[model samples]
Target: MEAESREAGPSAALMSAIVTEHFVLQSAAGTTVSEALGRSSLYLSALSSSLIALGFASQTPGLLLPFAAAALPTVFVLGVFTMVRLVGTGVQNVLYLSSISRIRGYYRTLDPEAARYFARWGAGEGETDDALGSLAVQGGPMAGLFTAASMIAIINGVLAGVCLALLTYYVVTDHHLPAALAVGLFAAATSLTVFFRYQHRRYLKVQQ
Candidate 1:
C-alpha cells in the first residue's frame, strides 16, 4: 500500500503538469493571433496616411483599388490569419456555449469538494509549476516568441547600421560632416524612440 501510494503521487503530478501546459499554449496562441492582427493594423494605417497625403482618391466613394496596392500585403496577411483562427473553432464554439450552461448548473450545486477543486485549479496555478514556465524555461514556443521578437530587434539594428553607412557616404561625398551628424543623430533618436514606445506599450499591456 505504501509503494502504491508513492507511485500514484507522481502519476497525479504528471497529469496536472499536462493540464498546466495546455492552458499556457492556449494563452500563447491567442497572443500570437493578436500580434499578427496588430501588424496588419500598422500596415493599414501607414497605407492610409501615405495614400491620403499623395491625393490618391477623389471625394467620391466608388473608386479605390489601383490606388491601394500598398495595402495588398496587409490584406493577404489578414486573410491567412483569419483561416488560422478558424482552427478548432467548431469545438470551442460548442464547448464554450455548453460549458456556460452546464458550468452554471454545476456551480449552483457546488459543495466543499468543488470549492477545493476551484481553489486548486480555478486560476490555473497548480501545485506544480506552469507548463510555459517549465517547458519554455529552457526552450519552446514561448522561447520561439522571444526569439521572434529578438529577430525583429536584430533586423531593426541592421537597418540602423545601413543608415549609419549611408550617413558615412554622405559625409565623405558632400564634405558636410555637420549635416551628416545631424541627420544621423536624428535618425538614431527617431528609431530608438519608436522602438522603445512600441516595447513600452507592449510591456504595459502585458502587465495589465
Candidate 2:
C-alpha cells in the first residue's frame, strides 16, 4: 500500500482538504491575535483615561505631571506589546493567505467547473492588492495609512507623543530644562527599543 501510494500520489481532494484545514487554522490564529490586541488596547485606554481623570480631580502636587511621568513607562510597555501582537496577527494572516494561494493553484490544475469555485473571490490569483498591497502605491496622498501596521504605528505614536510631553513637563517643572531633555532622550530610547526589539525583525526586515 505504501509503494502504491508513493507511485500514485495523493488525490486532489485530499490535498485540498489539507490545505483548507491549514487555512482555517491560520485564520483562527489571526482572529485570536486580533482579539488580544483589541482587549489590550481597550484596557490600556480605559486605565490611562481613568488615571488622568483621577489625577486631575485630586489635590496632587505637580499638577498630575508626576502621575503622567510614572505612566510613561507603562505606556511604552503597552505600545511594545501592541506591536508584538500586531506582528503575530500579521504573520498569521500571511500564512492564511499563502494557504489560500496554494489552494487556488491546486484549483487551477482542476477542470474548469471545479476551478470556477475558487475564482477571484477577492483574494485573487495574481492581483495581490487585497490588504497590504496598498504599500506599493505611490503618491495617493493617503496610501501610507492603509495597512494594519501603519494603523498600529499611528495610534501608538500619538500615545507616545502624549506620554513624552507629559514626562517632559513633569521633569521641567520638578527639575529643570536639562532634566526634561534627559527625559526626552529616554523617550527616544524607549521607542527605539520597542521598534528594534519587537517590530523591526518581524515587520521591517528585508526579504533578501
lDDT (Cα, 0-100) at 160 in candidate 2: 71
* Cα error, candidate 2, residue 50 (Å): 4.4
lDDT for model 2 comes to 0.56
Model 1 earns a TM-score of 0.31
TM-score of 2: 0.60
- For residue 146, model 2's alpha carbon misses the true position, in angstroms, by 3.6
lDDT of 2 by residue, 58-168 (tens): 576654655555665576566666666666666455445545555665666666586677554443333222223323432222333344554555556555755765556
Cα deviation at 208, candidate 2, in Å, is 6.5
Question: What lDDT would each prediction earn against the true structure?
Answer: 0.41, 0.56
Model 1 CA lDDT for position 13: 78
Report the Cα lDDT for residue 50, model 1. 48
* Candidate 2: stretches off by over 4 Å: 1-16, 19-23, 26-33, 36-40, 47-51, 54-63, 120-145, 172-208
